[model samples]
Target: MIEIIAISEAHVESFHRALDTVARERRYLAFLEAPPLAATRSFVLDMIAQRNPQFVALSGGDVVGWCDVQRLSRPIHAHGGILGMGLLQPFRGQGLGTRLIRHTLDAARAAGMSRVELSVHENNANAIALYKKVGFVIEGLQRNANKIDGVYGNVILMALLF
Candidate 1:
């Protein structure tokens, strides 16, 4: 059985592995690979310290997906957060994305976040659709915003306001 739960220190390494797997796909996240383990550990610890919303999908004690909402640092923008999430290839198309995102977003809302935003590659139709289904709306499009492997792609900005 798959479970979605808040991230904890014990889950950091597995979460890093899951992040690396998705990032190596090179078709979704801006990261082509996961950052160093130390850096990832620090990031996760900081998220926990700050009470940011971060969750992971666990299958048999291994992380297969994750979702996080990072609050902006500036005092004026503190009410808002940036959302990021991903799942392993095998886990896609199984509604895990919806489950992960909804859990994280609910945590964000309960933590006093008033807005959550994200940017998706235009080619990532599934992600865009998922975000829309979760109350996010396209705010703008940046033409040729990303150039991966010498190919340019547009980026769609989306946001959900509470």
Candidate 2:
């Protein structure tokens, strides 16, 4: 059974591995690969320090997916956060994304965030649909916002207001 739980320092390494696996796919996240381990560790630690919501999906003690919402640091933008999430290839299409996102968003709401936003590659229909299902609405589109492997792709901006 897979468990969706808040990320702690102990989970950082596994979470980093999962992040690298997804990012290396070069199809979802803006990152072509996960950042250096030290950077990822620092980011996760900062998120924890700031009380931002970050959760991981664990299967057999390994991170298989994650969801997080990072609130803007500026005072005026503190009410808002950027949401990000991903699942390992094998974990997709089984409702795990839905579960992970719901858990993270709930934490965000409880933490007093008023809005959550995300940008998704236009071709990621499943992710777009899942975002919509979770009450996120398309706010705008950026033309040719992402270029990967000599190919350009539009980005769909989405937001959910609490």
Candidate 3:
């Protein structure tokens, strides 16, 4: 059985494990390699302390997918939030990303967010399609946004305005 739940400090370990697994894929996430467990835990702790909203899809006590709506701390950008999402290998192609994204967006709206933004790799057709299906529109294209192993990749900047 899979459960979608709010993030908590207790999930630190499992979240770290899941993150490392996804980061190792080195395709979707920006990280080129798995980060240290301690660093990952600290990051999660800070996210919890700031009341940032994070949700995870769990099965058998392991994190299968996760999403976050990161609110900016600067007063000028407080009304804006950024979305980040990822899923384990076995969980893809099952509409899990859509489910996670929909849940996160709803939560963000209820939290009084005025806008949300996300950047998807330009080559990721499926992700771009999914974002479009969820009401996000392409606002601009970021040229050479990511340079991995001497190869530059474009990014599609998208947003949802309320």
User: lDDT tens digits, residues 31-87, model 3?
Assistant: 766578788778777777766778999989888889999898899999989988888
Q: Candidate 1 residues 52-125, lDDT tens each?
A: 99999999999999999999999999999999999999999999999999999999999999999999999999
Q: What is each predicted model's overall lDDT from 0 to 1? A: 0.96, 0.97, 0.86
Candidate 3 error regions (>4 Å): none
Could you give candidate 2's per-residue lDDT for residues 30-145 as a string of tens digits?
A: 99999999999999999999999999999999999999999998999999999999999999999999999999999999999999999999999999999999999999999999
| Model 3 lDDT-worst window of ten | 26-35
List TM-scores for all candidates, in order.
0.98, 0.99, 0.93
lDDT of 1: 0.96
- What lDDT does candidate 3 reach at residue 104? 86
Instruction: Using lDDT as the measure, name the better of candidate 1 and candidate 3.
Output: 1
Candidates 2 and 3, the one with greater TM-score: 2
Error of 1 at 36 (Å): 0.6
**lDDT value for model 2:** 0.97
